[model samples]
Target: MSATRTFLMELHCEEIPARFLTPLWENFVHLLEDKLEAWFPTGDSANYRKNAIDNSTGLYSPRKLAWRLVGLPAVQPDQTETQVGPPQRMCVGEDGKPTIQGLKFAEKWGMDFSAVRFEQPAGKKEPCAVVTLTKQGRPTVDLLAEALPGLIAGLHVPKAMRWGNSEFEFVRPIRNILCLFGDQVVPITVDGVTATNTTWGHRLYHREHPAPVVIATPGVYESALETAGVAVSVEARRTRIAQQLETLAAEVKGRVVADAELLDTLAEIVEFPKIVRGDFPADFLELPKEVLVTSLREHQKSFCIEGPDGALLPCFLTAANRTDDPAGFVKAGNEWVLKARLYDARFFFAEDRKHPLSDRLEKLMALTFQRELGSYHDKTGRVVALVKHFASRMSDDTDHIDRALEAARMAKCDLRTLMVGEFPELQGIMGGEYLRHEGAHEEVWMAVKEHYRPVGADDAIPGTPLGCLLSLCDKLDTVAGCFAVGLIPSGSKDPLALRRAGQGIVRILWERGWAFPPADLIAAALRVVGAKATKPTAETNEALMDFFRDRVAYQLELAGYAGSVRRSALAAGWEDLVDLKARCEALSAFAEDTRFASLAQSAKRIGNILKDEAPSTDFDDSLLAQPVEKVLAACLMKLELAPDQASLLHALANLAGPLEAFFNAVMVKCEDPALRAARLSLLHRLRQAFLRVADFSLWQ
Candidate 1:
């Protein structure tokens, strides 16, 4: 038995973009693990696996990407290699003696002619000549040295750059490559840089100490970097920044406005994080809270501070890469940059407010939403029509319908505002703010602002009824237009984000319990889109509905429904998303009953028997001659007539016994054609009842 070892590799490069660091490191780890696992299989037992790699640790900063694999075997186990050669017929002579081909094949594998055997490989029509040999495994260090260079080069990033005279490209120029196995260097090389035991520290913070940090072993890498003033671990830097931000915010009697995404980005942007608290003129707080927060985060990578009541406090915190700001230079620089950004924001706001959101409607005609789908102005018209169509169905009040229509007309107007032009994330938010400032109706403004709700899976749905209706109209119009223009999402390509739009519609309908049929909504939206829609009406309607069905299943899955349960519910019909969700929930709970498995199997049996046979559900009760069939019919009648027991689960439960008995005694395929058709119809009714809840046949 061989002892385990630790392997470490670090690639230090020019500053990587903050967004690319984490994903790049993750890709590197995935590639390394996949290759290593193949080279060293865990085998049958946990003890055998103990010799394979254990924990894998990946860390990244703007300037470095590092990975550590622990508990790796010093050498891979010897493997059995099988080499397949030419067909046995080609290798054999007429007399069954060794032919030239046979001899050459044996020699190629360093085996005698006697060692060659004939065996058919999978998917082959003829048996082929094969030779098996035991190959000795090489030392882990040598294997790594040969494999790491290519592995590093294979990493995929959003963008790559070439430097110096070399044709090699990476996210940035490679400055250093440090590779160590246990206490020894593995001798890997990537690009033009060769691996060594030495790596640089924080480029600016360690300038005074100015000597390369020499790591003697994989175990000392983290501590050694810490001594050199570099926080190599991303989590460590994130924690330190978070704690410092809280301490700084506490000093001002405010809390940091939490933004997990910005926090993650800032964590990767710096190596050794030093918090700098800065303030801008209080007048900046008068800007909409979203504008101030977005400017602070987007422009400066800073966190805004909020008072106890959640009002913006005109203060922000930034994470600077240094040990200390003894002269307060970092703080002053951050404050100056923030002030400049705020001044620009204020100017944009003042300019945008000069004309109300309504006045900007004409400007949208110039902004193309999609080349074929027309302009923002065109989309607004479609959305307004959609809102009118949906709102009428959703509400009978004239005021509610009018307010929703107004919101749809003004939702995209902010795309022309200078503030929104400067900050695209504030499009919907700016529209609402401008409307409110103009003294528009509160419902209309709120609807415009919240129409883009539930932007991500975890985001909140629109809070008000009018907002929900308007959101559905807006999202439905976008999905319908894009899908009509042949922009449907396939595989990983969804340039129009039709998937997200579809999901937003699903989440709003399911969460808000709206009962509008998705097909009707698509039809209405297509009608509003008019000639811009090129796809055939029926074909476009089905594609959009199928897209929505998938979104519904996805949302239900996210809500913790099982795959079979979701499939079953969706299999029945997803025309009404809210009803589909309710069915899923009921089926999920009912699946736990002790009789569920047998009943499900029986339901599946009923489907199999009735497949391709659609008998009229209106069967003659007099035709149910068998006592067992009579019992089943009676149970179904009691269920249908008993209005008090109308719940789907209860109906399913009551049929379980009668269905089991009916299948046991009734012969669905009988000698008598009329009686057979009657029995089939009876089974069909039972299947229909099952489908009312779910297509139980889809259950595993």
Candidate 2:
């Protein structure tokens, strides 16, 4: 082992996008450290010397990025080998002659049958043979060379590009590769680039200097790049950009909005960051606030500054490649870019307002959301119907429901608009904006915006009652329609994002305290589906119901309900969404009580014994000849037949006494034909009565 010291490294390339730089560099550093640890564990910090691998692993801000891994181990550990066969007890039994189980075990381990040796004592009850074993570990050098290539292969671009005759993929063309172990070159090659002890720095500034920069250790990597006019560390670059922005904003008596996303983008865009503050025309501030901000950030990659009260100022701050000219050049260039983007935005906004929201919806009817499923217009109609149905079930406000229906009717209208067609993510948001401009009712306008609530798991649900209803109805129609068309989501592949829609439904239900049975909502949706469905079959409907049921079970399980509780409640036949939840709650409570388990166990046992016998239609009291039968009948008579809460508890309580006594005295499977039939009939009566509470068989 040699003394540890800092090493410097670099990789140069053609222009690469700013966004690709950060992730690429991070991945490279992670892979390098992981490979180092796998090769040498104990000497990770102590024995290894500082080293430089790639200065910018893949950090390319429309140019290049590399990595610098310091403190790498010089050599790997010595190898050890071991091998073992079967367990001792299997080889020999009492008075052993090599047991059959032992022979099979030996065959599985690929051991020779002749190697077995049994030991026995005169007074011993059993004897066993121990199998010999050896173990071996692979040489570290071979592992390092083999594993590093695959780890490097795992590096990827958000989007890849093709170049020349090679089949390799990267964000841009791979021009070179650099690999080193302390001062020695690792002698590895990938994607037509060979690893070396040399790297390049600041391609544009050192255009004539193409010689590879030799770095001996990692500590020198960043300092060397700084001297060569490059910021090798992405974090260092980000910090510099943030600090510069803050300082620039203070001078102007305003604060930068400090959008994390914008900061990240800026960090990757420059290796040597130089913040340049520029101002746009005050007249352009007349544009919509969103338009103004989007123009600056999207086109110029600039951060917007705001006054102390939180209003956008006319000025913007941007990062440049370096402080080359320091004043006129960067500002002039950024302002030019902002002006072009804002000009286009202003043009589009004025042109789009010429047509009203309703007029746009009329044109949107021609666009199809799915080929066989129907158009956006068709979906809107289903949503309207679902919203009405949803509203009918609620005891809230009729006026709000009407407004929600109107909003749903007009929700997809923005799909036909020029502005929304360009920015699809702003679909529902634009609909609300357009409706407000048209002077529609406030409730109607708000519903249009809220209808698309919960686009993702973490997104907010509609806050208002009407908005909540609209969101649920819209999402349900999407899920039901997708299921109807046989376009159901599969593992990690929701082509239509139907699972997201289903999640939105669950979220809305939970948020609004609308504890309707998921099964009932699914059934209602299926009913709507049934009417609209041209193809009909019991099998298809069953498949659709099964899909919804699985999602329901998944949602409940994810919410932390036990499997047995879900089965128990579902077995009780709850179709109302709210009712099913209540049943699950009741069952969960009952499950915790010790007596309930015994009762459930008893029900399960009786269900198993009478499994072969068909349920009795008639409970003839004449069968009460047996003491158990007489007692069970009398108890059933005393319990009130309440189907809901009070009655459910009463019925469950009544069965407990008879159930216990029946199990104690009666043997249902009697040898005598007449007596067995009578006893079987009594058990069937109990099963039928018990089913009124829950189907115990489902618990199994």
Candidate 3:
């Protein structure tokens, strides 16, 4: 008989950061589903069938995320799959009908022609026969036993530890686990929590009187929990927090400053979200709004409220641990933290303004960006030089470029200032403010702030010419300096953020419509700082060049080029990144056309014969006595006259007939040495015809 089952699980922690709950919940749900699928194919399946059965599962996270799976079939249906045989022609005698071969096929499967079916084999239109094999499936109980424990065990956090004699590691110490098959416990345990039929409600809200929840069916388990006063859906928690914040903000004639990620993180941490309003002294509002807000968000984890005109308000809303007495307790706690954070920010900002940004440039000499790399000031020199070269080469506003260069020269100057030293994220922002106050041009001030444009993937690219130039130069220095210092990124290790820097360069150049090649930029920047670089071995330097080539290739590939096209372009060489991109794009354009398949096949065949190795220059054309060879040579000669794409493609088309005729008439690897060399040379010439496109063999 088919029946349903459910699993309810929860862990009581000692104040787990709300931020970690949602991700952990997602991880657990995914792991459980994957395990269940691997075992039964569908959670609804049971031990009663032999075919894959389908199932449904639900996951919810409020303070705690829970998954309920229901409507699972008891077993898989009977297996009835077919094993195909060779074509009927192979099974029939000269009579063109069933022979000994056909008899053997039928006898082997213990079936007659009635159970057998005939169809065309895949990739061929010729008819063939298949024997169906039918077998019953096993019970689902065995599948669940094998899958569940290990799947549950794999649900762990960023860091884990060993507990008790068991080896399972979870984010927190698990207290109880509930696994049910219909109304019966599945009989499982993790850490020390044995599977039960009950789970707890809201921690503090139900503190006075806890309720015992019954885990009957999948639906019953969740409904039972809801009756006990706990919300286990993360979306619900987030909505509550946002709604409460809006309501509280409206009361004070202001709007809640919406920050999704912050709200999301807060929602995951606590079960019962309570928006508590807090206020600071009006005097602190005198500081710049950015400083005030950063302190609130970064340090206090509070949302700063703003008036209708976008002016800073004294009030901030924070998510509290408990709903009771939140107004009194939360206000005091949050206000205290904000006051301390604002004081530090104000002190650093005031102290930093005492000196002009230009005067602090020398101080970067002592700041170490990395252990192997030299001081920050040394980096500034590299950046400044690169920016000047970029300015000269690219068509940008000269005044803006010069201002940008000046700004780049002093961009890292603020790193030495007490403000930037204390708050690293405020580097460019602080530099802009200080530069403007120091009597620098407005362009220079703007460029200083905009140089680090697009700090993340979704962030904006530089718009103004000076902004673009500085962004390009700054990223180039980061890539070059890291490579120079032997700090190249590898699989999963990009501490230097070389990947992000490369991405930034691609975005800036593409957005600004600059036709400059990134490979040329890398080479030029390398030349300027090559002497300062810790010289790597020839092999390592080659690897670094290959790394840059790969970065450019990946960006191009993501822009929608075929893998074959990308490989062909990259295989040609990595002399110029922009040219490589053009090559890939051009090849990709051809690859999409229906005519391309034939061209690709022809190129692939030539590539297969010649490989990448070029034929010996010593070609004895006299040995090519066949008319086909003579015709092919004539075609090659014509192709060499005008080697553009259309001409090359035309030449290849002309050789198609001659090349096919030659392959059919003459042996390529001849016994005679002179003849073989000529044949090889002919094939090599054919392969070279498409070399302007790509080496198709490299793609496969």
Q: Which candidate is the best by lDDT?
A: 1
lDDT string for model 1 (617-698, tens) is: 8888797788989888887775555443137577677677777888788788999888998888888877777777788778
Best by TM-score: 1
Candidate number with the higher lDDT (1 or 3): 1
Assess candidate 1 and give its TM-score to the true structure.
0.92
- For candidate 2, write residues 328-369 as lDDT tens digits: 888898888788877786777777779888887667669987
Q: Which stretches of model 2 miss by more than 4 angstroms?
A: 1-143, 146-162, 165-171, 204-212, 226-264, 267-269, 272-277, 294-297, 305-310, 323-325, 395-398, 527-700
TM-score of each: 0.92, 0.67, 0.71
What local distance difference test score does each model get? Answer: 0.85, 0.68, 0.69
Q: In candidate 2, how many clashes are counted? A: 39
Candidate 3 residues lying further than 4 Å off, grouped into runs, are 1-4, 18-38, 41-170, 221-229, 235-260, 274-290, 303-317, 320-340, 395-401, 513-519, 527-532, 535-537, 560-592, 609-700
Q: Please give the distance, in angstroms, between residue 224's alpha carbon in candidate 3 and its true position after superposition.
A: 4.3
All candidates: CA RMSD (Å): 3.4, 8.5, 9.1
Candidate 3 per-residue lDDT, tens place, 165-251, comes to 867786556666666555556666666667677776666646676665666655666556655655566666678999999999999
What is the Å distance of residue 252 in model 3 from its true position? 8.8
